[model samples]
Target: MFCSDDPVQLQLPVLETGFPYGELEELLSFLQSDNPTVSPNNSGSEGSNRTLSSPDDRKRRRMMSNRESARRSRWRKKKHLEDTTNELNQLGAENQELKSQLDYVASRFFAVQAENERLRSECASLSARLSDLHWILLAMQNHINPR
Candidate 1:
């Protein structure tokens, strides 16, 4: 009986010696067969009686159920973590975009304010020049007509 963990060491000698093929085929089929005793679709009340017939069978069924439940729980947790990471990345990009827009709006607001100040200064200078012209015109009219 071969007890080594390496299958190549067992298979190489077995094949070279022309051993009985039927036993090898049976052993291979049994080793490869990993079908679960209870199918997930029929694990409810409908199949409970079969697993409950013997204490050993009940224990095995419970163990398999626990393993399946743990596998699903781990998968759900991994999916949730991935979803949270994606959402964080999306929100970060949106925040950066909003900051960029705010900066542009602020720059435009400052430029408009400076332009308004310049226009106000020019309007005051033009009003003062107009008032002086009006006074000069009045003096000219008085000199010409003596009124």
Candidate 2:
């Protein structure tokens, strides 16, 4: 078994044929000092300086990483749902505002159309009165000239 403290002198017969010794030493050193920021438990327990050695330790670490990733993914999904809901609400309000504007414009258009019709009818009445007055003036001029 390779000692964690003296990883420099540790050599594996399996890797001795092809792998470089210096790289193996570096790999062992890195694996032994895994999670250096995590302090040792204060429970006066044996193996306080336990490092990741067996395949089980690596599997456990991978499981923990997967769990954390799953948690973040759920959080992201919830946030996206909330964002989509807010956007939907905003669009609905904008749609309502546009509808209101369209209604007001439509009402104004109808009012102008009615006013134009009233003005056109009044113009026709005035033109008929002018034509009658012109006919009366011509009749008076013909009687005075006796022609």
Candidate 3:
């Protein structure tokens, strides 16, 4: 009833505990005392009206606090999601780099295998040619020493 003329314009503080403990004592005193003051130059009717409006004021405070807490939780959730996204991106990049390194190692292994096979073939050919030369030398010695 204090702001009956401007009900839609009422603004409640968002925090429930933001009002000091001492202020609550003063408010209680005003409610219990024989004379209650509503506003400057206001009459008895407004003071009586405030008694009925007190419950509504308490409800408004509760609602405002709930809204503020909900807003903060949403912001925190968004930040967590953003952090997870960054981590996933970094892991994907690292995975790609590791894949490339594996490919490079595989290519090097194949090159070494090819080189080993070529060297083995060359050794086999050289060994065969050396055996043929030894046989010819033995045959010449026998012809020279026929006596």
Among all candidates shown, the one with the greatest TM-score: 2
lDDT (Cα) of model 1 = 0.70
RMSD (Cα, Å) of model 3:
10.0
Q: In candidate 2, how many Å is residue 120 off?
A: 1.0
lDDT of 2 by residue, 33-131 (tens): 653333343333434434324466688668855765687688889999999999999999999999999999999999999999999999999999999
What C-alpha lDDT, on a 0 to 100 scale, does residue 94 get in candidate 3?
99
lDDT by residue (1-147, candidate 1, tens digit) is 333333332233454422257855654554334222454456477456655655765565578557656876888899999999999999999999999999999999999999999999999999999999999999999999994
Q: Model 3, stretches more than 4 Å misplaced?
A: 1-58, 138-147
What CA RMSD would candidate 1 show?
14.5
Q: Which numbered prediction scores highest in lDDT against the true structure?
A: 3
Weakest 10 consecutive residues of candidate 2 by summed lDDT:
35-44
Error of 2 at 50 (Å): 9.5
**Residue 108 of candidate 2: its Cα lDDT?**
100
State the lDDT at 72 in candidate 3.
Answer: 67
Give candidate 2 misplaced runs (Cα > 4 Å). 1-53
Residue 88, model 3: Cα distance from true site in angstroms? 1.4
Measured by TM-score, how close is model 3 to the native structure?
0.53
lDDT of each: 0.70, 0.70, 0.71
